[model samples]
Target chain A: MILPVYAQVDLTNGRWRKCTISAKLFEQYLGGKALGARLLTDLTPAGLDPLSPEAVLIVNTGPMNDTGAPSSSRFNMTFKNVLTGGIASSNCGGPFGMLLKKAGFDGLILCGKAPELSMVVVEDGKIRIEPCPQLQGLDTERIQEELPERYGKLVIGPAGENQVRFACAASGERVAGRCGAGAVMGSKNLKAIIAFGTREVVKANPEGFEAHTRKWVKQLKKHPMTGDSLPRYGSAGLVSKANASGVLPTRNFTRGRYEHYEDVSGETLADTKLLRNSGCVSCPIRCERRVKVKGKDVKGPEYETLGLFGPNLENNNLDLINELNYRCDLLGMDTISLAGTIAFAMELQEKGMGDFGLKPGQPEDLLRVVEDVACRRGPAGELAEGSKILSEKYGGADFAIHSKGLELASYEPRKSVGMGLGYATANRGGCHLNGGYLALLESVGVISMDAQTPKGKPELTVFFQNGMEAASAAGFCLFTMQAMIPGILFKFGPASFVCRAAGKAMLAARPLLSQIWKCMPWIMPINCMLVPHSKSIALATGLPMTIGKFFTVGERSYNVERLYNLREGLTRADDALPERLTKTPQEPDQPDTVVPLDQMLPVYYKVRGWDAHGVPTAKRLRHLGIPLPEEG
Target chain B: MAQVRYHGHLADLTGCRQEALEGTTVAKLLDQIKRQHGAEAYRLAKRSHIIVDRRSAGAEKGFRTPAGLDSLVEFIPVCGGG
Candidate 1:
């Protein structure tokens, strides 16, 4: 059978080693987040700072990557978070994953630090660590332009080179934008990594994989959410839904609604600013919006960038949002964190905590602050430290609006309480995708459950989280997974009795679902529904990829990350949202409008089989086939 | 009569953002729209969520609910990206 291979690089000594994963480990963890998490846990030394020379960066692709699977040209980077000091798995959509595998490696692991500014080149199964000081300090776009277009390049810019806590790595306008992975690359004095190869990915069953791919692409194209709405407006389409749902996160999350939200809404973007639509390799949905920034056509802002840079900072200029989005991309900074930090600074100044010279409704200062944060100059240097640290120093912990150091996404959790639970308990901290993205079901998506209610949220949160984790591990775009919700549900409006029953049925299945999880391998295997990634994986890797096994793989991956975080000194205390989310109600007259995290946390812990302290029980770990950490 | 304002492509299909339609429930309003425009208008309506008087109908009031007298309705297309 074709087992996964890891190319291990010792950056300190400039040597590389090839290691094939064992069958036992391969069976338990597929590629991408699953295998990467376990590898990082085993290979990384304890107590190592994320930016230290010794910390490891593991880039992995799923079994179906480059096999013509829909949106399968995705990869994951797993490492210690520079901001949170916890497990961080950031997924990106680009040709890099396909190129990396074509170069004859399923994954690449980098350890130690280079002595000087350097670049790693992989071509035709050969690896070369070359010293390249000329590429240092260049913007992400200029660096990419300087490199040969034939190679898929992953590069960082000033934000990363300066080791900004929220630095992101850019690849063909796609980004691994969370957990400061780019900063870790910067700390190692690594400027960029370019991959080029002509190798073909061999599928175990070529005909079966091809049939599955055709059907999968058809499904994605036909699905209303993926085919029509996304391609038409891109992710910016969600701006209107989020704002209407009272979850747009205005003014550092002080309120959930924005009056001028229409100025930057997706409808406005599509009508006035959108130039064309684009997407990653092998993706049919093509949800990317190509818009003009400073007279040059570039990737438009997604929901996070639109909401955060637009309303969260109280900026009503869509043109400014597009400009900032492009600037952040060039600077290699995560917009969520960078924008959140600036918003936090603005609030701090408003509250008389510190003077960073930022004010509400002032969009002009934002451009200068973006530059300052990327270059680590002036007051933006302190802003580069992220909101969690700034709050600790400046005394605004209650309204800091972050969970576990990383800034919260644009979705205001008080309006969607389950999202609050997700933010508080997410492994990577303050990430919407990591927190299960229940906002889709609760308020934003087709199924409209009560947003402020906490009942049955824990179970739904776990279900979405597990499914998303499995999909990410399989190297599929999360948007493809959105089709898993039956089309009939969209046919029936959210207020219909059918939709409510569906919601109730989902919540009611918690007990049976928990039992099935406990049964593990004994449970009957099925391919499940619209999520065809498992079936494709089974045929491609010759591995048994039944739905049960797929979920188990995801569960194992999540538990392993939890185990790592636990070892790194994370406790239940860290699994929490800010006071503004949990205690303060968005609608003061309505006491129930606040996120009732207290009601959900206990139930969530119980469902996950973790003790009151949120540590996974040894029995739970063993059941998932994960070895307990030494401390355990 | 309920006032309906279309968003995204829904507006393009109807050739107007706001219109007055005679209907109590969203289904009937969609039926009237389909009769006046075409199947595409009905298709767009099906895939879109109605916001009654600026509040999202996804919450307590879905398409099944009545348009309540003089309710200013907004048809926002159902799209997922984030």
Candidate 2:
């Protein structure tokens, strides 16, 4: 089997070199975030400023990328965490990953600041760092328009150029939309990277892989979560479910339910505004919504944008949200961080602590504020620093609604305590997907596993975090994992006795699950129908992969990231939520409404084989084939 | 009398967002919904996640859970994360 090749580009010297990882290491890391994390750790020093010239940025693809696997076109970007000051990895559904592979490279390792504004061009295994002063200060769309349409593009906008703390990198309309990757690009004076090639991705067993992928795609199409609900409503469909489950963030997370929720709901979007549905390359489940914004069709807001910009701001207008989503994307800003920052600023105004000329339920100046934040102009410029810094400058740290300096997603974790635990313990700080997204089972998905219960969450969180980490490294969309939930469960429904029993059974079986998780590769020898990723990887890459080994890779990935974070000086204390979420209840009469993070932290640590201080044990590292700090 | 709400596709089938219905329990409220709307609407409602007074009905007693006179009941379609 041919080993994956990576391009190591030095912006300082304007030179590049080709590098390859050993087959053994490839099996262990499995590419994407895992491989990126390992590469970043090896290339950079501890406590290095994420935006410094010395810091490394790795944009990479998994073995499944560009292959025939469904929703397999995802690429990952990893750098030092610009938000949390730890390890940062963001995934995007775009053509760049496919094109990069076709260009005879699996990844790019970039270091040093360019002497001038530059764009890296990769074509058929050759690399060039060309000056692109003409593309400076261009919005994401304009930059892409200026480039060749046939080439896969990854570009940043004004927010990135200005170093907005939550700026994102865009590839088409999809984004690696978290942890300030765009700002790092801007700091390096890199404007964009474009690639084009005609090479084909090879598979170890093409026939078997194709058959497996076809069956998997069929399963996704038949599943209720992927096939029907997602296609019909997109992710905005969860607005009603989140609202009904009392997990919807409202009024800056002070409340759980929104009176005007349906006004900005997925149902409403589909009924009134939807122009069409779209999807990423090689994806069978097309969950993206297309809506008309200012008479032009653009990408619609996801649940995070809708929840944060809608009920969290007390703004019921759906049209306004679509416009905001488009505007943020154009500006290369992260909507979740931007909206959360705005909500915090609004709350500050409410408390009379400061005046930012923004208020909840009053969105007249929102458009201006969005631009101001992107440009870092006026008082709104303070918001460009993000909520953590704003809270430190102001005095609302208690209600800041972020963990490890990154703002939480839309799910009001006070209602779904498992999600709350997830927000607190996630490696990337407040990322729902990285936190195991237990909110799926607890609040939104067909399984209704007592949203408020912390009983089995720690074990489940570890299980899912590991699974998702591995799947992402394998280059599949997290949405594909939704198919793991059996169709029979959806038929029974959440309200049915069978479904309720299953939820309870899961919680009751937590100890066994925890043991199974701890046992690792020994417990699961075969690929599971529920999880097709392991088999897919084995068939595509000639790797000896199984459900057990797949999860072990995920665990290794998680630990490697943890080690990076630890090396960067993050500790157990960094795994934290704001006081408001941990201390204050959403409902006054309901004492149990708050997130009991303290109760679950110990259990979570223990389940992950970490010590009392949340440090990965030396024995655990050795068991996972991970080198210790000194050894590395 | 309780305020019964339909969300997502349910509202399209019921032709209204919410209305006052006579029921003392969630099961009874669902029955009232079926009587007012049709079997299809009822099936959708049955499959949905029922919320009473901002809490999941499943978290309480499922279909048999009590719905008081002033209760605000919502039937929301199940959905996945974005």
Candidate 3:
């Protein structure tokens, strides 16, 4: 197998250089976020502004990308986070990653500012920086439409151009939607990136890889969560379950239960608005929902957008959510941050703190405010700074729903305490997937784990965070990780005694799991069918991959990002949820409903082999094969 | 009598979104649904996430959990993450 090659593009000089990664580095960091993190650490200095021309943006693909692996079309963009001023990595599923690999590059490292509005084009391994001043101020869709159809496109819109702090980069309808990668692109005056090539990705054990992938695809198809729930209802399927479990954010997270939840639910959308179901390339679990917006077909809202824009804002119109989702994507903005920021602004108006012509359940100004945010126009443009900045400018820091400057996803973690812990400790601010998405086990998935208890949450969070980080770095969709939970468990259902018993058993086995995680990778050398990721990597790259090694890579990846964040001056205090989640209970009568973040944080640090200060110890770093930073 | 609500496919199976049911406990509620809708609807409803008075029945005593008058028993279909 060929080692990964990265193209270093100097936008200012309009020159590029190809650098092949060493086998040692490839085996250690793998690709995607892990590789990007390692590269960023080496190339960037501490305290550099994220929205400066000196900021580095790495668009990367993993070994599995374009290799016919299920959900292998996913790619990652890593840069200095504009929202948090920490290490930022965002993943997206689209044709860009696949075509980039085909164009003979595993990644693109962009630096320096372009002399003018520009587009980077790579065709059959030839790279060029072409000025495209005419594409200025266009929405993401219009920019893509202007580009050649055959080239896989990654473009930014007006929000990115305006340097909205929560801006995102668009790849077709999919997005690298969190941590403001688009602002970094716009800082470099990059309007778009297009790649096209026909090179085939070669695997070390092609036949073995093919057979394993076939079986993996079959298992994914047979699994209840991947096959039925996701494909049928998309990620929005979690709406009813989250609401039923009291984790749905309502009225800007002041309450967990929404009175009119049924009106904005996944079932309602599927029944009323859905045109069809779609997905990323090579993915059997087609979880994308297609719906009509203003007589044109577009992507539907995910659970985050639906919950945050619906009940969180006291709105029950599902059609409005569809329009907002389409509008946000077109304008190159993240729906989670945008909705979260809007909700914060509405609450500020309610408190008579500051009015930005926004209110809960008021639809008259919703579309206009959204457009103004993207264009950075008038009072709504203040919202472009996001909730953290708004809270600083005004008051109500206690109710500002963000951690480390990045806004939280729609899961009202006051009820799902483990998810709250994940949100607080997640490397990339308040990302659910990065924080382990424990809500899947605690409230939404087959397991009905004790949501309020912090008893065994730390260990479980570490295990999940590591697993997901590795899966993402390997270029598989996070949805595939659902198969790790046996399909038989889903058959039992959440109400079954057996299912409840399984949840308890997992918590009970925390010590054993922790020990296993800390032990050497050689402890579990065998490849298991339950987790196809390790075997897939072993076959594709001929690397000595195992379940234990796969997790270690995840652990290494997470630690690398944490180290980068630390280098940027992030401290233990940065790992925190707002007072609304940590101090206030969702149900006033239920004092224990609040996320016991204090109780969980110490345990979480201990489980992660970090000191009480939450700084990773030298022993842990050495064990993970990461070099201790100079400060350490 | 408790107001029992069904969500998603469960509502389609039971042929109603909500109704007043004669039951003092969750087990009795399932039996009532069985008599009203059919055995398949009863089975599906049994597997659902039951929320009584806005709290998960799974967090309580499951089918044996009490459902008094003015209780709102909601059966929500199980699904995966966002």
Candidate 4:
């Protein structure tokens, strides 16, 4: 079996299929983010309107999923993003990844639009896709309540039905919420996809799983930031960290730092509003915080959401923040996107851009806009299409905080140069979570190659992107480490362990990363592979190999993704960041503020063997098991 | 001279979180605090925020500023909410 567990759903046929793709030709490259993009290339239409039924959604799960890797629950869902006007890979976590695997599937691919309003229900291996007109007006809260108690449901809201370009799909309170995926579902007339199962995932080698799980879980608990600050405060804690640095997004990305930022920080929220802790299905670290707002507790207001509503618009009332958070979840909108939409409106209104219909610091007016956006009611609704669309209408493009049409999250690039590069070049459009290299750039500071200068940003960001992609492929949460530490970044990931080692060689390495990488370099991605210094896979899985063969698999997969994007036309232009970084040096509220991306991207591409266009060459592709484009 | 201010939960911990100290160097200021508040208090104070004027002033940097009897630095650790 190549891919351990994944599900394929055909909305038209109401069927579910599972397979292991680890042994597929591209299996050597491994379908991590790179392979997932390739798979979409195999299916998704080029230049097609993203919201059409023909557009396919590919959710990629990696081999290490549910194997107890730190933050191992993150899964990537790729689709044409109408909001960004480009491709996007949205990540989310809930029970769906583990359940599908338990039920014997590697990943889920939804194809062929439903004939009418319908919801596909997968229970006990039985698949049923049919029309459900009853779901038309329902929001995520309603859908979450109605879905089977033991199942995970993915559904879109009314904004999607209205074909609002910025609409999203939410699973429970966790949203694959960016890039208008919900809008795509709406276009397909597929209201929801509910998956259920009770079967246990039978491990091929339970001993290996247990050993890997214990080692990682212990390390995660010992991680200073993850163990102490994170679980207690959640990403909400950054509310204070960012604001204190004068790098918080306020007044529609107009400036960094908010006068009232301290009031809405994560610590304040945890002290006042945090009611409970929630998590995805099998995750031991319950990092998802449920906060009480307006008397009703809801999922969360993560860092981006806090930035969007708190500093971006100058709203500091935790009560209002709570209510706003609830509104986004129930309205079936993404908090990050919804917050940006409102912030954009605030900018237009403040600037007298024909009063584009909202005011800064007015929560009630913001709420009205939220309603309008979700239901596509009027001018406000149209303006709410997404931040980029809203910004262009207001006669401002340069000041508009978005990449490729997707609104930028809360990070102020002026505060950190590496993050500036990451935001500019994120595969999913202005998302910090996607690359999240800034976390490393500041504290852990990998690619020590250079941190103060943008000399090697592209390389740094790409390495993180590929490594993170590998982790997420295993369907793990990125929160395993509060910040991405260089040690873990270059160290042993158990999935890399098993993937690298041949039976006998793995036995000798027995938990040592170096041995695994040398023995099975051919099986893992080669660009940057880390293996156990010593460990025997044969003793556990009966498979053994030396380390040299393992590193190639991972490195090969990294290059394949670049080649795939090359096929889809993600060129030099696409590889660039926003105008803000390119022209004006970002100045923070503090002194010595200077954005440094001007020096980073070149060194980055060189390290990956990609030409200036960000395309991996023919030689790189041949090495990774990725087939080059056929000469016509 | 430097002014130190208390902030957030840390402010509540100190009896008077914000204050001004006279010294030519951070080490001198810290030494003065050691003599006045005792080593235990000075040790605890080091763990918190110390603002000079309005910008962040570390213990090392706060004491290094030109020493004088005037309070040109605002040593703050009181409002740190981040």
Candidate 5:
């Protein structure tokens, strides 16, 4: 039988060892984020500096990955975040994961720093580390171009070389953007990792898996959220919804509305700038925007890049946003964190605490600023540390716009309180996906519950978080889960009685839903159309997979990350938003317009079976089959 | 009559940012706009959410919500997912 296997590389000595995941662990966790988290918790040393050689980085693939499943060409990277000082798992859609798996390994573990700058290559189940001094200091695009085209490559650029706190690792045009994974590679003196192979994935139930993939692809194409909106405008389509709902982060999140929102909206991008819509491999929803940057075509900005760089900076220029996004990508810096930090710097200048020469609605010198941060030059060097450190040095902690040191995304959560709660409590820190992306239901999607209300948020947040966790762990794009809302809701509109009933039903089912997590291992039946992942996983791995077992895996993954953070000294105090988000109302006239985090946290903790201190109870950990931290 | 504001592509279909439409309910107002703009607006409207006075029209009652004379109704097309 084909079992999940991993390659452990000791970069310090250039030695490689291969090991198989025990059948028990394989059955309990899928091979992506869930398995990566499990390995991280077991192998990662406690209290090690995230940038140190002792800190290990794991890249893992899911069972469906490269198995001809729709939108399954994604990978997960788990490591300690330099910025958050907690567990980090970043996902990306690129050829690297597929190549890695096809090369006869489900995952790779990198430990110890290289003695010199080098590139690690894996081909035909063999691993080799080679010195590549000539490639040092090159940008991501140049490095990618210089690498052999036959092999899939992962590379970091100047931002990572400089060890910018939120540097990213790029694979093709896709990036593992959040959590400084690139910086960890840089610290190890690794420039890139390439994978090449000529083996086909072995599936246990090939026919069943093939049937599920076909049905799933058709379902994904038929869904409006994925098939229509995403394919047409990519993620940039949310600009108008965020703006109209008063949730668009403008001018360092001081306001939720932008006056010139349309200028940088997805509609404008589609009308004026879009070359075409692109996507990852096996994806029916081509939600990638290909637009011109400089004289050449490049991947365009997503909503986070557009919103943060556009309205959040008070700049109405989509062209400038695209250029900056390209710059961030090439430099290996995360656009979300980069934009959030710049917005915070702009606010710092507005407060007369410091002058970074940044201003609202100004595009001048922005490109220069991006270059400086990537190279760690002058004031940009300080800014490269992220907003959290800058806030500590300066005094705008209230308006720093970060959670647990990681910067917030474009969604202004004061309006979407569940998203606010998500930012505060996400294990990876201020991450939308890790925070369960409840804003899609509460504010953006057709499932319009009350955006500002905290009622049902804790339960809904838990439900969505668990569901997203399972889907993400199964290696499907979170966008694939968009079909779960049912297409009828979109057809009838959010104003229809059915949509309202749908929202209310979710709210009303909170009690039952809260209990479902514990009962998951037995109750959930497998289907490809609704919850297709379980059946897909079973057919692919020959494991006894069920919808219930899948939910258990998600729960275990989340709790494992939380326990890792807890062991690393993160507490409930760290699970918080900036004062600006909680204390200052988005609408000056409306005192209650701020996020009601205080009201939601206790309930959220209760539903998660955590203590008032926000740490999971021993009973809860035992119930999920996760090990309790030694300190706990 | 209610002042119905259109956003995103919905604005392009209706050819006006804001229109004064005669109807007692949001449903009737949307029907009038759909009839005037034809299938394009109808398709966009079906995918869009109707908000009355800055709040959700609470999907259950949808167009049945009272669009009273001075209400500011919005046809904000749904393009959410990032």
Candidate 6:
């Protein structure tokens, strides 16, 4: 049962307010930026400092939570961004988002500063604000360890305590770190959020649950993307795939193809030190690979982690990288942004900028710097505010890959024009969590994209952005979207409201509605008239809702977060890729080729309803229930 | 028409995972193999810097076969492991 009507439960004046949004609004603007846009406009004030306690940090779970949504681990957190001073919202996948729903909490919105260090504990159907001196200033990994095995953790490290501009909220080894959200958490003097609940949020139908899960799990097992390849090789497989496709970013985004990528693929991991396969809770596909060095088991970093720490740094030492990754995780930091910042320092050192006090290919020296980064100590530490800060201090804004202060994820945008647009306009800055277009660019090749040509890329990118937004808002896993489609099966869960959300998502096949209706003719007997229903709340909760109503709520939440960015003073200029993708095609590994991004961006913006400057139009916002408030 | 044998990684690269591919043009063979096996697994054509009878075949370049189209063409994709 929903603790309050609709998925959004607003707490104010010690009473709960239930909001029912329309499905049209939900489909038009789903999750992440769209939800953030609505929420921030409503909640954020003008010229709000992102690091101030006045920053409204909303941990919003997507519509897909509590359903057997495969790879539906996505959830959003919006705040005044410390990086680009724009509207910022970061999405991530882990147990925390799922647990929030299970605990009967849709999302957590905490405003007003705490006088001292405190932790939010949700255990056994109760939420309490408690002080925890011991948890203060602890690194993320240590805090994760302190949590009972049954509970999920969202904690920050010394970077947050130091108010490092790029600090992240780490859960297990995954993170929602960017735009100093962790620093926002720290500014509130909040230490951690430990959540535990006994009630299982599995679907109401046990037999349907078993059959549905088994069928999808079987499909996943058979689909080459997940079964044999990703399960065994993990994301590391992308190293070679992108390299072969001529888009592996190497030597600090100078080239799309890494001549040394052979040294980093999943095949290399399988041949070398890969110790075991790992996975998230309730995940049938084990995509994480556990590696060992000196007999110390370390969480094997993903492709994004490897892209930055390995090839991006010009460091090819595999064994040493294992230890370096271990140090990052133990310190509770996001390796992607960390590597991006370090790469900036390395570029500075190579160009006779006289050592930002760094040794480019030396993993051991880099390991020492990890602690300093997390704590913002010493030379490289000061710029550890993030990659964009390092770029501003140095002279390589050309190479600094960030949007709104958050560094880019591991995908080389030069190879995937669609992905490049996704990175450029992501609400939380350069982030792949918004949408990963590599499946179309290199793996599945479903979108008929001339990846090397940039033809139709902008339109394709816009399509992916919308589809991903809808899927993630429904809270389903994205990896599945890469290979298969998540369809009407979702309506049985919170994600099903998007069944009609297809108009927003550009699909290869027709919409799920047509497909479902067509299948009904085959599955059911003749002369059956099935009527459409509104976005109804769960029967267990007895709350009334219309399909049109829920999406409006979802879109309203998105706008509020966008306003948070506007309050932070972010503008169109803040939403774009570095010169590597825009002004110049990345220098080809072959010595004379270009990624052709110039041929892409204009087309991308047209479909997105954004101006060439990358700002969403007033017409666009009005259609999606996003109110544009007065600006500074 | 010329035939190329699929072996080891190439076998995995081919749709059959064991059988060789037949084609008149080098591009056709590679495209056929990739379509069946999936592009993610067919990167062997680039990785294995190969050699036919005597001369070298460029890693990614497509080429015509020898006069004797029925000759036993060699499968020499570059094979390296760290």
TM-score of 5: 0.97
Model 4 lDDT tens row, A93-145: 75565555444555667787787899877667666786888778888778778
Q: Which candidate would rank higher by lDDT, 5 or 6?
A: 5
What candidate 1 gets wrong by more than 4 Å, as runs, is B1-3, B19-39, B64-70
Q: What is candidate 5's fraction of native contacts? A: 0.69
Per-residue alpha-carbon lDDT of model 1 for A389-456, expressed as tens digits? 99989989998988999899989988888899999888999999988999888778887677777888
lDDT values, one for every candidate: 0.86, 0.90, 0.90, 0.59, 0.87, 0.58
Clashes of 4: 105
A405-491: candidate 5 lDDT, tens digit per residue: 999998999889999999888889998888889889878889768777788888888877777887888788988878777887888
State each candidate's clash count.
1, 0, 0, 105, 5, 45
State the iRMSD of every prediction, in order shown.
1.8, 1.2, 1.3, 13.3, 1.8, 15.7
- Comparing 4 and 6 by lDDT, which wins? 4
The residue ranges of model 4 lying beyond 4 angstroms of the native Cα positions read A5-8, A13-22, A25-34, A67-70, A391-394, A443-452, A481-566, A585-596, B1-82
- Per-model TM-score of chain B: 0.86, 0.96, 0.97, 0.54, 0.87, 0.53
Alpha-carbon error at A153 in model 1, in Å?
Answer: 0.7
DockQ of 5: 0.64
After aligning candidate 6 to the native by TM-score, how far in Å is the CA of A267 from where it should be?
0.9
lDDT for residue A253 in candidate 4, whole number 0-100: 65
- Which 10 consecutive positions of candidate 4 chain A have the poorest summed lDDT? A491-500
Clashing pairs in 3: none
lDDT of 1: 0.86
Q: Give the local distance difference test score of model 3.
A: 0.90
Q: Give all TM-scores, in the order shown.
A: 0.97, 0.98, 0.98, 0.82, 0.97, 0.77
